[model samples]
Target: MASPPPHALIIPYPAQGHVIPLMELAHAMVDRGFIVTFVNSEFNHARVVAAMSPSSSPGNNGVGGLDRIRLVAVPDGMEPGEDRNNLVRLTILMTEFMAPAVEELIHRSGEEDGEEKITCMVTDYNVGTWAVDVARRTGIRSAAVWPASAAVMATLLSFNKLIEDDIIDAEHGSAMGKETFKLSPEMPEMQSAHLAWNCVGDHDQQATLFKYLVKGVLAVDQCEFFICNSFHAAEPGAFSLFPKLLPIGPLLTGERGGDKAVGHLWQPEDAECISWLDAQPEPGSVVYVAFGSFTMFDRRQFQELALGLELCGRPFLWVVRPDIGYGKVHDYPDGFLDRVVGESGGTGRGKLVSWAPQQRVLAHPSVGCFVSHCGWNSTMEGVRNGVPFLAWPYFADQFVNQVYISDVWKVGLKAVKDEEAGVITKEHIADRVEVLMGDAGIRERVEELKKAAHESIQDGGSSHGNFDKFVEAMKQA
Candidate 1:
């Protein structure tokens, strides 16, 4: 009989944005003849299975190659039905509560007979030092994966220096009066006001997040090899900082020549949106708008966004989930949907859904520009599809990503925010959308990045070679 394929266990932080790319990595491994087991928190495992179950929606089938890959779960030490969306709560749960359960799972898998013994582990960047220690104690080969941009990782890794220079407080809030600081001459410039954890919540919460990030960086320092879901050519300066870092990404679900197996926590509304795109009059004429799974906007911001898309008078597909505005209903401006979508549905001005098949939306030929919250996955998806963006960053690494997209990459434009209210108004959104849609130069740059992303994953390319090297190292270990 043939020797059993190498077994690997993949763990992702249990959030939608984090799970999506990590699932892409899992699929990539399975295609390479590895037996992959994907482990999620009990909460997310149910979410995934429920969202992908045949009964949920006809379109919501499981990930591609599902028969070959195993799905498993471990308790996250939360009371049943507790909210997993709170980042601070998740940090505490993963580090303080879930580590023992995860370690036990890792240990028990190795004790199993035959081909089921785990040969390696792929862990989320925030899984903490305990995971690395577990791998060492158990003798399993391991690597860390950062789902965000490499540039953001590079910045966070240098948080200690920022502390030493007094540019930011070590234990308290941001340093006074310094709006911007550069980590290094090569790193992209950063605004202190836009620091991932800055001003997110009250003082205690902000401090907790800062401490969590620092712990993650220290944990990353212990890992032998680190992987980022980004193309090498895209962020040269950022990649130069960490010698062990590997860049083999823009890791799209469809890139491996397999059927796209998107891991959506919420089921997409359906093929109606795709059909709508097909009916658009011109190629690259439709605008695609999605702000990712997180990010809650206030009532005023929501109204402004609705009016802005209508004001632009472009054919568009917008995904607006009910959960987008805290625990409140998403109340769009009065008569907004009516004005945009006529009764006949023949005018084809706009189509809206609670959720979207984003990769599919970006891949469509009618998609000219993207209005986005600039989540890392969305940024890469836009790049993969050659779609330029009108960046409307919400928070966290999104602000950092906006700098790269608009300033460094020059493939997108950042939306201007109102000075006092701190929201991007209808007028500002309309103007930026017009600028993005009309600019041939922006379109050309995005196409170039798209080609570069595609090329990196081809035979003998940088990403391909790096992935080959990674697999070999695992086998040899």
Candidate 2:
């Protein structure tokens, strides 16, 4: 008799950044003959279903031309009208609520909608390890997926080490006034104050995040594998410093060989931007600026960013997501849109979209530089396309990712915020864009990383081998 096909239930923390990459991982699993049940928050499930190509069905939500994958959602312990953008509310609810919801789903798995017995589980660390414990109770194998760069996870896993080394205060997790330090000699140098949890929010929020980290570290020993969406070739030092982390990523869902487009939380609303990009004659002349979904700006900073793109002069494709603070409907400074991005998101030197097909945008030949928030997904996309960056880090791991891109990788330059104004002004934005696009060396270095990224995902590369080993080991369990 043949064995039952492995059914893996995959869940990500409830965020667009988290969902997209994990969806890519599920796609890969289906290719490897696993029956993947991808889980999302009720809100995210609707958004992802709406964004999928060929139109996703509520009854069957497989995406990207894969038949073995299914999409499911569980309540995130929130009211239907509650604001999920509130991090504190989200953290409290998910911590107190998500485990039970997921447990219920597992308990009912064999009873409905052609569902098979869940043989394994994969979940993000931010969603808490309670789900992992539940998997163990159900006698299913489990793994934790770190959605950030391996180095970011290194910083998280090194909290006690930081205390032991006297780099941060044990009580508050604040930096002990040291200017800079390294986790190990091999790891990249990081500012003591820029510890992963420190830069997230205020002291209370930081403490909440810190609590999660401590719990995750303690519970990680039970999981069979702790993998990350990072490439070993990109962060050898981080990998060496934390050998437990296996790198199996740079998962570009926009595969080179014409795979169907992947689902996005926000649908790509502007096709003209790509046409605008193609019209640029130079090999790499267009500036592509996009901050991922969670970045918010006050009215002043929002105006500054708009005017900065206007001042940058070079042709640019900017994805201005509708909810970048100041409400869903925001107005730029007077005459700003008229002067740069004219009617139909074109006719002028710049074009703006509510959302973009990011991987496709980065892969365009005319796109020379990425003005980014340094979200790990953005970081991976930029590296995969060999686009040098003008880093505008907002918060959290973004600052550390900036250090890696500008200081360690030498393929980008960080935008300097005005000490008095506390934002990167239009003049500074123009200056950085010019410098980043003109640097031949930065361009060359990123091309090297881009090559490594593609190689790592191909047959026999480090990521390929690591993934193969993981899948084989999971099959046994």
**For each candidate, what is the lDDT?**
0.78, 0.82
User: What C-alpha lDDT does candidate 2 achieve relative to the native structure?
Assistant: 0.82
Q: For residues 1-477, write the lDDT of model 1, one tens digit per residue.
A: 966677887888888888888888988887887878888888887777665634334343335325546777787777786766677777777766667776777777746555477878888887745667667777888888998888888767878777777778888546556778887678778887677777366667778888877887777676666888898878888888865679888888422233334566766446578888888879998889898888788888888888898998888888878663532433767777578866554354978777777888899999989999999999999998999999988877899999999998899999888998778888888888898989999999999999999999899778888888887676654
lDDT of 2 by residue, 137-232 (tens): 888888888888888888878888888888887877888867789888888889977777888778888877778777888777788998889999
Can you give the TM-score per candidate against the true fold?
Answer: 0.93, 0.95
**Runs off by more than 4 Å, candidate 1:** 1-3, 53-65, 110-115, 253-260, 324-330, 343-348, 420-422
TM-score of 1: 0.93
Looking at candidate 2, what is the lDDT of residue 444? 92
